[model samples]
Structures are given as structure tokens and as C-alpha cells.
Target: MSTFLLEIGTEELPADFARLALPQLEQLVRRDLTEQRLSHGVVTTTSTPRRIALLVEGLPAAAADLEEERKGPPAGQAFKDGVPTPAAIGFAKRCGIAPEALELRDTPKGPFVFARVLERGRPTAAVLAEHIPQWIGALQGRRFMRWGEGESRFSRPVRWLVALLDATVISVTLQGSDPEVRAGNTSRGHRLLAESVTIPSAGAYAESLAAVGVQVDRAGRAAAIRSAVLEAAAALGARPDLPDDLFDELTDLVEAPLLIEGSVAEQSLGLPPEVLSTVMRAHQRYVPLYRSGAASDPLALDAKDALLPRFLCIGNGLPAASDTVRRGNERVLKARLADAEFFVQADRAVPSIDRRDQLARVTFAEGLGSLLDRVERIEWLTDVLLEQLQLGAATGDHARRAAHLCKHDLVSQMVGEFPELQGIIGGKYLLAEGEPRAVALAVLEHYLPRGAGDDLPSSDAGAVVALAERLELLLSIYAKGERPSGSSDPYALRRAGNGLLQILWERGWSLDLQALLRRATAHWSQLLPHFSVQAPALATELAEFLRQRLVSLLEEQGVDGDLVQAVAGEGVAIERVLSDPADARQRADLLAALRASGELAGVQAVVTRAARLAEKGSLDAARLSPAGVVDAALFEKPSEAAMLQVLEQLQPIAAGEGAARYGELARALAASRDTLAAFFDGDQSVMVMADEPAVRTNRLNLLGVLRNQASVLADFSRIAG
Candidate 1:
């Protein structure tokens, strides 16, 4: 057995992309190796900000040998006069064997020519050399940079490639834009110190890099950065609000991790806390601090806390040696925050509402008109969703008001500077303008769950407004042919579509999705003059997209695929699925049970046949003959009368609700087992067929009705006995 090591050294990749892409790469490698029939190992995978690594231990030096069988045309067709013919010879050649290697075999389609061959195992190194390029090529990201244009696209340049089979560096070359590529025993370390280091084996890679100043473990690097920043803040008697995302991002930007404490200008403290925090984190990747003794003050940080600033940053090395770098970063952060503070104060003086008319200056999307126009379309659609939901008449006015003001903040200085803060700032502005809290939050949360597993709106009004906004974006963008492709979703349409479903599901309302969609899209039809792109008949297509999402959500919840096919087999009511008192697991069990009972199966078959015959409509009990009760003279045996009794007793009980109806009918059938056995033993088919046409039809109808009645509780045909 030998160990395997694969490393992909690349230029700095975006922190967020690295975090997601590396695990995917590891999984892909594991799957590929396993599929290749390489056994005997536990796979280990790891990622640093710059590279993704995989190590497999206990893997055999070569793949195991295996036997394979090949089939050809029938034996009768392949042989002529009891000797091998041209057809047989041709098959042998196709299988890479001589005629003598062929054999005869029996098959479902008479007999056929066959060949048994044993394949020899190849060295693991040979396999790795052949597969690595394809493996890397399969890796993708939201955005990839193509270096030198020779079909090489990665988040960054492929700086170094390390492939070791055991301790040997496998001989492999990558052909791409860079042209020259070779497997190597040496890899680079922290860019600041000992940038180039030799790695002897898979086991030595981590230690080799660490000794030269790089923390190859992303988690450790992150921990080191966080612990240092917090410790520095505690020493100053304050709290360090280290943003987790910013900390993660900074760790990836360097090979060696360093923790530094920096401060903003004292005069800048007058800005809103959120405004200041967003600017620092967004522009400078700094962790904000709160003075336990006093509010975070830039001057105090430069004074008593001078050694400890209002913001703490983790660079890639020691602060003493990087003084110029530290001071320079601080100056840049202060300037960004100063601009933020100025924007906030200026926007307040001209409040976003007063600037609403100015929204025409801002284009939400080129050719799609301005922010003001999108708001108008959204406002109109909001009314349609409200009407479909039959919300209080007051809701229409509120939705319109919320929609009109939702994008108002896009023009505000705070939002203009930081696009991520658009909805948040809008919400704040609404509250300040004396709008209701619900309306304000809707403005903010209508874009709730900007991504998967994110929060959703909690109020009905909020949900309604959210649905309207998302549908508008989806229709408008899809009309422009800007839909997400492969792994890229530039407009975040997938997230928006998902968020719309989540809000409806969480709200547990049975609003008619198709109707809501029709109304919403109809409103868009009128709003096209405001759009430059020909609206791509997207309203209907988008509705189907949402239905597909709902189906997926149901499947994930463990609903029976068949039941999902049956229930949602047609159009699904969003509300019914959300309101199912029995969770998905329970519904799955019920479906399984219904399809597992023998009596249920028999009953379903009979009922289905009867239903087809009486396709006109259901027959009333009055229409059924009282004299039609199994007559001993008309009945073939006691069993026929017994089945009748069971049917009559169950018909009414099965009309009731839930498991009780199912249980009671099952008991009724069980009770009549002996009689039904006698009736079938005597063969009642003769008597029923012997009756007059009307009488026979009535008898069959009675049997049909019995089958139909049993079907209500469960599909007997699906039951397995």
C-alpha cells in the first residue's frame, strides 16, 4: 500500500470562493478514486487559502485486477456449419481477442457468443498522471480568471503542481497557457520568508510550510488571527467585535498570519455605529472594538488605548517589522470611514424620501430603466399578490407604500457607498421617516435570505412584499436572458426564487401560486415600457421554476416520491404542503403502509375497474338495490354475503377521517375472512354473470362500489399483500 498526495498551488483566490471550492475539490477526488476501484484506504482532504490538498493512505500501489465479460450476436448466428464464421471472428477482434478466445453462452434471447477477459492492474502513478489534469479542469468557481488564454481558467494562476505517489514525485506535465508544467517535490511557503520550500512526502507538507512562516491549516490561521485580536482588545478593557467573515477573508489574503491593532480617527466616532462598522469591515477588513470603560474612541485609542486602537487587524507578520504597512492601512481605513460619515449626514438632511424623485438618475439595470421605474412595477405587482391572498384591504396601501420606498435608499449616500447595506439602510430610513415598524422591516427583509439557509420575513405583509419583489426581479432579469448558468448566478435569481418559496412555506398560507403568478406577470406586461429588454414570456416559466423548487423541498422533507408525484403530480398548493399536520416523515409512512397491504391492493384494483365503468359519476346508496343485498338464492355461497356485509359496514366508516377510517375498514375485512373464503371457494362469479343484464350490472356495480369505498382509505392495488 502507498500514500497519495495531491496539491494545487494557485495565486490568491477570493476568501469566500476558497472556502467553498476546496471541499468540492476534495469530494470530487475521493469520488473519482473510489469509482476507479482503488480500495484499501481512508482519504484525507485539506485546504489552505492558496491550495487544496488530498492524501489517501493504505491505497494499493496498483489497482486490483478484475474479470469482465463481453457478449456478441446469438450463437446460432455466429456459427456456420459448426465452424466459426466471419461474424464470430469480427466480435473477437472487437473485444481485442482471437477467435480461440471466444466461447458460447446461453442468454434470454437464445444463445450468443461471449468472451471472458482479465485486465491487468496498472501502477497508481500512471493513473494519477493521467487523471489529475482532468480533475483540475472539472473544478469551477463563480468567476474564474483565464491566464494567457490557452484554455486555462482558475480562480487564479496555477503556480505549482505537486503529485506524489508514496514519496516519489510522479512525472506529469500540465499543458495550458503557461505551457511549462511539471510535478515537483518542492512547494512555496509564506511569500515573506522562505517562499520556496521542498516537500519530501505527503506527511511533510504541513510541517515544511509551517517551519518557514506559513500556517497551511486555514482553521489554525483563522484561530490565530481571532485569538490575537480578542486578547489585544481585552487588555485594553474593551470588546472586539471581530466580524467572522472579515477574519476569514484576511487570513486568505496572506501566507503568514499577523495580528495588529489599529484605530480610526476620534472625530469619526460621531457616525452611527452600524455605518462605522460597515465601512471598516467592508473597505479595510478591520474588526471593530468597544471600549468597556468608554465608547470606542479614535483619540482615546491613540491615547490611553493608543497602543490598542478602536479597530484591530491581523496582517501576515509582526507589527514592529511592518510599521509602514500598519500605519498606511490605518490611514486608508480612516479616510473611507470619514467619507461614510459624510454621506450619512448629508443624506439625512435631504432624507431619502425627498430624494425619491432623484432615483431616476440611478439605473437598477441598464435598459431596464431607473430605480424609480422598478419600484413602480413592484408596487403594482404587490397589489396583485395582496388581492390573491385576500389580505385586508389595508394591505394594498401598505404594500404600495413599502414598495415605493423600498428602493429609495439606493439613492441614499449610505446605500450608494455600500451596496450590501441597501435594504438595511432603507429599513432604517423608513423607521426614521415614521413608517410603521412592519412596513420598514418589510422594506429590509423583502430581500430576506439573500442566500440559502438565510433568514426569512416573519410577517404576512412582509412575506407578500417579498414575493412581489422577487417575482419582479426574476421576470425582469430572465426576460433579459440573464439567468444563472452552471455555477454562476450573477443576479442572485436562484436565491431570490428560493427565498420566495421559503417565505410562503414558513407562513403556511395556501395562496394560489398560479393565480398569484398570473396577476403578478400581468402587471409586468404593462410595465414593459419602462424596460428595454423584450420581457421574455418569463412569468409562466418562473412559476414552473418555483414549483420545481417546491417539489425539491418536499422530497428533501422525506415525502414519498410517488406521493409527491401523485399529490404534486398535478399542480401543488403551496399551503397544503406547508400545513400538513403530519410532518413529511409521517406522510411517507402512511404512503408506504397504504401500498403494502394485500386487501388494500385487491380493493384498489376492483375500485379502479369500477370507477372506469361508472365514469359518469358516483352512485348514491338509494340508487344501490336494498334487494341487491347478497341473496342466498342469488349468491353462490356464504362468502358472497360475508363480503357484502364487510362492504356495507365499511362504506360509511371509511367516509370519516384519518387512520380511524383505515383501521375500522381493515378490521371489517379481517372479521369477514372466513365467509369471504367460503364465497370465493364456491365461486360467486357464476351467479353474478347469470343474472339479467340490469341485475348483473347492478351486482357488478355493488362490487365496484365496495371496491371504490375501500379505495378512499387506501389504494388497494398498490398494497402488496
Candidate 2:
């Protein structure tokens, strides 16, 4: 067993880039090792602002030998009457084996000649030396750079390489315009705290680096940071606002973290808590502090008192000089907060109404009209959805108002400088203007769930407006041939689609998606006749797109693939899918449970037998019987009469709303399975396609009637066993 280490030293990397790319680097090394037939165990990666290190343990010195089959020409061509021909001889020579060493093997293409070859695996050190450079080059992230005009792109400039197999160094040339740096045992420590240090062996890598103030282990660094913050906050009788994402980023930003307390300006406290936190955490990478004199949860900041005007930051060096770094950061943050205040004050100089007109100058897309034009589309679409949901005028008024107000902040100064604060800033501005609280909050809630796992809109009006806006965006962009394809979703239409479906699922409103899409297309056609030139063609495309997104969402929720397919099968209305995703899911769950419980075997048999006959037997009669009518007078079997009576009873119940109703319909269908079986299985069984013309037509009409009635609920034929 051997301990392998790879250290890529580079210039300071962004915390996010290092944190995201380090895991991929570790995986790439593991994959390369596995592909070379090298077995390893406990591969782990750690990173700081300056370097990423992959330390693997329990790795064998060499890969195990492999036996492989090398197939050659067919038997007919390889030999002539049991004698080796030139073809066979040449193939055996190429395989580095004598002709007799080859064996006859039977293949799909008839008899073929095969050769058995033993391949001795190379040493692990030799393989790592060859692939180390390739693995490093393969590391990528959202932002990568090629320093010194070289094609060797990385998160930052590569300054040193440390690749070792056991006690010996494995050399590799980065093979680009990069300086000819060779892998060695030498490794550097904290850029500010410690100088260069030499790692004697792979086992001593962590201990030697720790001597120089570099905490190479990510878990150790995070723990140190947390302990420092908690101890510091304890002195002030407050809790540190240390969320996981911020904590990770802070830990990655420094090799030697030292916690320091800084003061938030008194004037900045007058600003909104969002603004305060944004300035402290987002702009300065500092954690906010809260005041707590009582015995509240030490880890929690929420209490009856206001948040204290203080913040804590993790410095990259020893605490002795951290005061200077803290003051510098505080000065920089004060300037940013001052700028935010200025932008907010300037935005208020002009009334929100006046700012809305400026949106006409801001283009939504190249061909699509300005932002104001989109507002009109969203307003119209939102009102239509409200009406579809059967909501009264009061809700419609709130949704429309929210739609109009939502994008107004896009043109505001505060949001222009801080794009992430778009919706929240708009809500704050509306509240300050004395708008209704519902209208104000709806402006914010429409952008709820900005990402996966985020909250859905809390209010019904907000959900409606959110759906309308996303639907309009999808239809308008897809109309312009800008549909998301092959992951090139420039318009983020997929996220828009996701948000729309999420709102529907959360609100549980059964708005007709197919109808809404068609309506949106129509609205675009009238509003932008030139832009929506092919508006009529977009409805079906957009519906299928939304269906795929919904499928992805449902599958991601751990629903059975076959059950999801079954519930979303033929005649599964798109309106029901988008309006009541939960109900559709419930139907799938109910059917899946019944199928697994063996409660629907008889029902399945009846549906399979009847639907199969319904297709071939009832063709001409079904074409004539659009209403699927069967004359009672023509019924010869009592079983047929009894089934028709039961079908009539199940009609209104199956057609009723809710998943419970669908479950009841399934039970009723299962209950009638015996009578349906008797109709087809017994001695008095009537031929659906009888020789008598009237009997054939009447029986075919009867099967068609049953099928047509079942069509209202689901296409049982598409259901999977």
C-alpha cells in the first residue's frame, strides 16, 4: 500500500471556484487511476485560496495483470482446410502470439478466430506521472483562466506542482506555455503567515504544512473558524450569523483563519436589515451579530431585541495584525453602504409611476417590445388565470397590480447596482410609498423560489402573478424561436417553467395549462403582431415543453418512473397536470398502491381485454358512434345489460373532481371486473364481432361505450403493469 499526494499550488483562487472545483479534481484523479487498473482507497481532496490537494491512502504500488481476448478474422478466411493461411498468420503476428495460440470462437457472424493475451499492468507511479498533467488540465469551473497566454487554463495561475508516490517525487511537465515547473516534495504555506516548506513524504504532508500556519484539512479549518466565531460572540452576549454557504466560503478564503470583530456604523443600522446583512456578508464577507442579554439559544440570534450594530470577519493571518485588516474592511463596507443609501434616495426622487414609464426604453428582447409591453402581457395573462381559477375580482386586482409593479424595480438605481435585490428592493419601495401590504408583499413573493428548494409564493395572488409572468416569458421567447435546446437555455426558460409548475403545485389551483398556453399565444399575437408572427404554432410546443419539465420535477421527487408515465399517459389533461400537480401525483400513488397490492389484477385484465377488443372490434361502430351509444333493446346477454347499468352509475363519480374520486372510480372498475370477465369468459359469451350484422354493431357499440367512458379518467391502455 502507498499514500499518493498531488498538490497544485496557484495564485489566490476565489473561494467559490476553489470549493466547487476541488471535488472534481479529486474525482478526475480517482478515475484516471481506476482506468489504469490501479486500486486505491480513501481518496479525499482539500483546498485553500492558494492550492488544492488530493491525498489518497491504501493504494497498491502496481495494477493487477489482465487477461483479454483479441478477436481476429473469421474461421473461413483465417484458414484453408485446417491449414493456417497468410491472413491467420498475419493476425496472430499482429497479436504477438503464435498461430496455434489462437483459438476458434463462435460469434454472431459465425465462427471467428480469437487470441488469448496476458497484459501486464504498469506501475502506479509511472501511470500517475503520465496522467497528472492531463488531470490538472481537465479541472474546470464557471470561471477559469489561462495565465501567461498559455492554453493551460485553471482557476488561478499555477506556481508550483507537488506530486509524490510514497517517498519519491513523480515528475510531470504541465506541457503548455506555463513555466517548466516539475513536481517535487516542496509545498508552500499561508501566503502571509508562513514561507515555503518541504514535505518529506506523503504521510507527513498535513503535519509539515500545519507547522507553517496552513490548515490543509477543510474540516479542521471550518471547525477552527466556527470555534473562533462562537467564542468571540460569547464575549459580546450575541450569536454569529454563520450559515453553511457563507461559512464554507469563508473557510476556503483563508489558509489560516483568525476571527475578528468589527463595528457596523450607527447610520447603516437605520437601513433595512436586508441592506445591512447584504453589506456585511455579501460585500465584505463578514458575519452579522445580534444582541441577546437573556439566556437565549447561544447559536441563535432571533430574540425580542434588535440586531446589534456589529459584525465578525475571519482574517487570513494571526490575530495580532487582524485589527488593521478589520478596520480596512470596515472602511470599505461603510463606503458601499453609503452608496446603497444614495441609490435608494435617488430612486425615491422620482415617483415609482414615473420610473415605470422609463421601462419602455428598456428592451426585454431583441424582437420583443420593451419592459412595459411585457407588463401588459403579464397583466392580461394573470387576469385570465384568475378567471380560470374562478377567483373573484378582488384577487384579480391584486395579481394584476403585482404584475405591473414587479418589474418596475428592474429600472431602479438600487437594483441596478445590486441586481440580486431586485424584487426585495421593489417590495420595500412599495411599502415605503404606503401601498397595500398584500400588493407590496406580492411584488416580492412572485420571485419566490428563485432557485431549487427555495420557498414557493405564500399568497394565492402572488402565485398567480408568478405563473402568468413565467408563462408569458416562455410563450414569447419560444414564439421568437429562442426555445431552450441542448442546454443552451439563454432565456432561462427552463427555470421559468419550473417556477410556474412549482407555483401550481404549491397553490393547488387547477388552471388549464393547455388553455393558458393557447391564450398566451393569442395574447402575444394581438400585442406584438410582428414579433409573434408564428404565434399559432407555439401552443403545442410550449405544452410539451412544460410537460417534460413537470415530468422531470415528478421523477426527481422519487415517484416511480412507470407510475409517472401511467398518470401522465394519453388523455391526461394538461390543465389537470399544471393546475393540480399534487392531485395527478396522488392518482399515480393510488394506482401504484392498488397495483402492488394485487387489488387491480382483475381490473387490469378487464381493461386489457375490453380495450383490445374496443380497438379491433368496434372500429366501424365507434366511428359511427361518436357519442358511444348502445341500444338497450339489442343486448342479448344479461351480463352486458348489468355492465351497462354499472357503467352508468360510475359515469358522474369518475368524472368528478379530486384524486379520491379517481380512486373510487378505480374501485368501481375493479368491482365490475368479474361481471366484465363473465361477459367475455362464460358459455353465453357474446361475440363482439358476430356474423349477424346488427349483433356485431350492437356489441361493438357496447365495448366502445365502455372505452369512451373510461377515457374521461385515464387511458388505461397506456398504464404499465
Candidate 3:
């Protein structure tokens, strides 16, 4: 066995692109080695802005030969008169065997001839040498570019390649201009600090890079960055705010990073702390420093007046130029802040109502009309949602106003310059213009939890508007005949769907997006007369789409898949797993837990059987008709009478509300198990399919009510057990 390494060097790549491509490169190499019949242990891949390297430990000295069974013509046909026919002879030749050696085997289609064929595996190096270059070329990027007149594509121009096995160089090119430099032990380090280092062997790759001021291990590099920034901020009596995303980018951006703390120009301190922090994060990709009180708790950005005039910077190279770097960066930020301050002052001079009018001319999407039209739809949808969810009346005025002005700031000069500040800037502007705090907060919260695990709207008004925005966009966009197809979600319907589900889950709102989408289509038809209206059909499709997301949300929380399926049973509008999302999840969790305790089988069986039988009848078509009605005059057996009594007792309890409703129903059903069991199986068993029509119909309807209404909380029909 030998240790292997492959280092791909390129012109300084974007931090995000490098981080994304490294894992891909590693996985590709591992897959290639596996397919080549090479035995190897752990595979490791790591990247810096300029390089992505892979290490495969304990790889085989040579590939292993594999044997496969090849089947041929039926034995009856192959051996007519016990002689090799042309088909039999050709098959044996293809398998590298003589026809006489073919063995007879019984298969589904009768007896067949089979042969053991050995496919010789090439030597490990021999196989890798032929495919490694193609493997490297197979790696993809966010966007590809062909550099310097070559046919090769990469995120950035390839510079050098180092590929080795133990002490020998692997025979593969990284696919670029350099052909003379065979893959070997040489690797470059820290662009302007260390020149180069010769790796002694694949195992020594990390140590060699570290000696030249580069940390190859991502965790070690990130730790060093955190320690440096924290220490620097502590010295200045400030705390550094290190968001994971930015920290990861910084780790990718530098081989030997240095932390630089700089002053924030006292004049700029008067600006909103968010303005300062935004400038640092979005434009500069630096962690922002915060001023903390005696307890070392960083003050909120909302504590505008108390913000300290200091910031942090991460320099990618030579620490000797830290002061120069800090001074240059400070000057750049000062100029940007001055521009921002000017925009803020100019923006505040105009009222939000005036800015709201500007949106009338801004297009939201191709066929979706203008931002002004979209806002009208959202405002209308917000009203409908609030009414549907039965949110308090006071939320209506604030949420409507917030919806009206949510996109107003996008037309502002400041937001135009800083696109990411759209929602945050809108809220700030609204507040400065003296809008109600509820309105301002709603405007800000509408874009809540922008991505996975992001915070949701905290206030009811915010949640209402947020839900309105996401629901309206989903319907309006789909109406334009542009659904998210594959990796290209040009419209982030997935994210919007996630936000919608999140709002429902968080507030336990029973607001149905299916109903909302149908209403939204009506709203859009009125607003954009020329737009094609995809109604009730899209509503069904969109509901199923969102339903899948609901299942995913529950599964993410560790609920079993069958449990989620069971809870979401029947189909589409017939049942909704998200009618009261939190409650639905609650029911799913409780039911799943009870079943896992091995206690629900008896009751679950009764529920499943009733549902299974009821489903075969018109109870679904006439679902509106009240079920479980029976002609007591037809009751002949005591067992049948007892079961009827149990059903009557459950009717009132099933109509109850609160967390205990489903639990109580479950207990009641479990309690009636023996009686129903006897009624179905006893010698005096009531014939559910009796010769008399009315009598048999009544019996089925009795069970129908149990499946259709009693177990409506969570469909037991869908439960796997």
C-alpha cells in the first residue's frame, strides 16, 4: 500500500468557489480510485484560495481482478443433440471460454447456460495514469472559464499541479498550459511570503505547507483566525462578531491570514451601526467589531448612540504591512460611508409614501407587472391570511401598511448601491420617517429567515406580511409558467416555500397555502389582466409541492417517514398535514411516539381496517354527507349495540379542541377495541355486506364514520404499522 496526494494549484480563486470545488475534487478522485479496483483507506480534501489538495492513504500497490457471471442462451436450445450451436459458441467466445465448459443453470425463463468470466484489472498506477487527468477535468465550478487560448475550463486559470504516489509522481496533468511539469512533490505557498516547498512524501504534505506559513487543515486555519481576531478586538475593548459564513470564506481566502484592527473614522460613528456593519461584511468581507459594556455583552446594533468607532479586518498576507493595509482599508470605508450618509440624508428628505409611488415604475418580474402591483397583491393577500388565521384585528392596519411599503426602499439610492440592504434599509427608512414601530418591524421581518435555519418573524404583524409576501410570489411566479426546474430555481420558490412552511409551523397558523394560492390567482387576474391565470389546477399542484416540503420539515425533526406519510394520507385536498401545522406535527409526534412504544397496534389496526373498507365506497364522493349514521332498527346483536354506543360516545369528544383532542380520541378508540373486534368476528357477527341493502349499508357507514371522521386528526390509513 502507498499514500497518494494530488494538489491542484490555480490563480487566486474566489473563496466561495474554492470552498465548493474542494469537496467535489476529493470525492471525484475517491470514486475514480474505487472504480479502478484500487483498495484505499481514508480520503481527505482541503482547499485554500489558490489550491485544492487530496490525500488518499493506504492505497493498494495494484488493482484486483474481478469475476462476473455471464448468462447465455437456454440450455435446451444450446444443447440440442448435446452439440454447441452457433449462438452457444459465440457466447462462449465472448466470455473467453470454450462452449464445452458452459454450465447449465435454471432461470425464470427455463434452463440457461452460464459462464464465469474474469475481467483482468489493470495495475493501480496503470489505471490511474490513464484516468486521473480526466477525473480532474470532470470537476465543475460555479462558472467555468477557458483561460489563455486553451480548451480547458476552470473557475480560475490553472497554474501548477502536484500529484504523487508514495515517492513517485502520478502520470496525470491538471489540464492547462503547463505540460512539461509532471505531477510531483512540489507545491507553492503563501503568495508573497514563502516561495515554494518540496513535499518529501504524500504523508508529509500538511507539515511541509505549514512550515512555509500555510495551514493546510481548515479547522486549524479557522482557529488561528478566531484567536487572532478575538485577541486583537479584546486589546481594543471590543468583541468581534464572527458569523460562520464569513469565517469560512476568510479561511478559504488566505493561506496565511493576519488580523488587522482599525479605527472607524469618528464621523461615520453617527451613522446607523447596521450601516457600518453592512459596509464591513458585504463589501469588505470582514468581521465587524462591537463595543461591549462591563459585562462584555456586545451591545445591539439598535443601540446606535453607544457604538464604538472601531472595526476588524482580515489581511490575506504579510503581517509586516498590517498598518498600511489598515490605513488603506479605513480610507476606502470612510469614502463608502460618506456616500452612504449622503444617501441616507437624501432618502430621509422624501417621505416613504413618495418612495412607494416610485415602485410603480419598477418591474418585479417579466409578466408579474410592477413592484407597485405586486405590493397591492401582497397587501390584499395579507388581509385574507390574517382573516383566515383569525389573527387579531389590530394586525390588519399595520400589516397592510407594511406590505404597501416593503419594496419601497429598493428604489432608494442607498439600497440601489447595496442590494442586500433591501429589507433592512426599508425598515430603517420607515422608522426614521416616523412610521409606526409595528409597520417598520413588519417591513423588516417580511424577509425573515432568508435561508435555512434563519430567524423567523417575531411579531404577529411581521409574520402576517412575511407569509403574504412568500405566498403571493409563489402563486404569481407559477402563474407565469416558470416553475423551478432542476438546479435552476431562477425564482427561489424552494426558499419561499420553506419560509411559508416555517411561518405556518412557527405560529401554528391553520392558513392553507392551497386556498391562499387560489385566492392569489384571482388577485393577480385583477391586477395583471394579460397574465395567464393558472387556477385550481396549480393550486392542487402547489399544495402537493408544499406538502412534500411539509413531510421534509417533519422528517428533518426526526419524525419517521411512514409516520409523516400516515399523517398526510388519502391525497391532496382530501387531507392536509399542515391544516394547523404545529398541531399536525404534534399529532404526528405523539402518534409516532405511541406506536414506537408498541401500544397503538390494536387501535391502529381497527382504524386502518375501517379506513381501508370505507375508502372503497362513496363516503369520499359524498364526503360532505355526515358518516356513521345507522338504522338502529336494524341492530340485531348485543355486540353491534355495544359498538354503536362506543361510536356515539366518541362523536362529542372528537369535536373537542386543544392538545388533548387527538390523545383522548386515541384512548377512546383503543378502549372500544374488544367490542368492535367481537362485533366483526363473533358468531352473532353483524354482516356488514348482508343480503339486505339498508342493513349492509348501515353497517359499512358505521365503520365509515370511524375512518372518515374519528381518525381524521391523523390518517391511520397512512400509518405504516
Question: How would you order the candidates by lDDT, starting with the best?
Answer: 2, 3, 1
lDDT of 2 by residue, 1-721 (tens): 9999999998888888877777788888878888888888899888888888999898887888888889999999999999989999999999889998889989888999999988899888888899888888787787777778667788788999999887889977787746756789998987765678999999899998999999889889999999989998888888777878899889889888888888877877666666667667777789988666534321121222456878899988776788888889889888998998898889878777777889999999978889988888888888788778977777778877888887888999988888877777787778778777777778888887787888898877888888878887887888777767796988888899888887877776776787777767876777767764555577878877888887777778776676676667434666556555666766766767787888866777777677778776535422313235667777888887876777687777755776568778788888887777777878757778888887777777667766755554456777666
lDDT of 1 by residue, 83-177 (tens): 88899988888888888888987777888899887777777788778888887888878788877656788888888989887679988788784
Give the candidate order by descending TM-score: 3, 2, 1
Per-model clash counts, in order, read 6, 0, 1
- lDDT for model 1, please: 0.68
Alpha carbon lDDT of each predicted model: 0.68, 0.78, 0.78
lDDT pick, better of 1 and 2 = 2
The estimated TM-scores of all candidates read 0.68, 0.86, 0.87
- The Cα error of candidate 2 at residue 692, in Å, is 4.4
How accurate locally is residue 16 in candidate 1, as Cα lDDT from 0 to 100?
A: 79
Indicate which candidate wins on lDDT.
2
Q: Model 3: per-residue lDDT, tens digit, 1-721? A: 8888888878888878866777787778777787878888988888877888888898887888889998898897788798998989999999998898899989889999999988887877777678767766888778778777667777887777887888787777554553333676789988776678898888899999988878888768888988988898788787677788888888888888788877778878767677778888888876777776723212222434545677777787687889899999989988888898998888888888898999999999998878998898888888888778776667888888899898899889888888877888889878877888888888988999798888999888999999888888888887787888779998899889888888877887766555666676666666666765656676776777777777778888788877787776445243355455566677887887788777688988877777777665555432312334676788878877777787777777776677677888777887888887877786866767778878777777777776755555566766675
